[model samples]
Target: MGAEEVLTVISNVGIWRLLKAVGRSRQRLGLDAQRRRLVRSIVAHEERRRVDSEAHP
Candidate 1:
């Protein structure tokens, strides 16, 4: 999923719950690396955006 959708999902699920799910997923078989990477990248992107906005504002 894209960053916007991923952000939506994170908002809906709650970040703590999503992080828990990711941790649990790693313990299970058939882990989806691509999805995890996407989430990570999106999270990093959001973090950067937030920092940038705050810095400029």
Candidate 2:
């Protein structure tokens, strides 16, 4: 998907679903390497926050 579409999906669905969506849309979207890296970064950041919150709570 394009940049805006990717950002929109990330914001609306959160990292996990966005990752899943990316898998589903890989052929259709043809997202470039940079975009994939960006998505991975976001997912990693979100995962860290999840772990931090769970440990704190």
TM per prediction: 0.46, 0.46
Local distance difference test, per candidate?
Answer: 0.82, 0.83
- True-structure RMSD, every candidate: 14.3, 14.1
Tens digits of per-residue lDDT for model 2 on 1-57? 899999998787886777777696674465576689899999999999999999999
Per-residue lDDT tens digits for candidate 1, residues 1-57, read 899999998797897687778787664433577678889999999999999999999
**Candidate 2: residue pairs that collide:** none
For model 1, what is the error of residue 44's alpha carbon versus the real structure, in angstroms, after optimal superposition? Answer: 0.2
Model 2 weakest lDDT span, ten residues long: 24-33
Off by over 4 Å in 1: 1-31
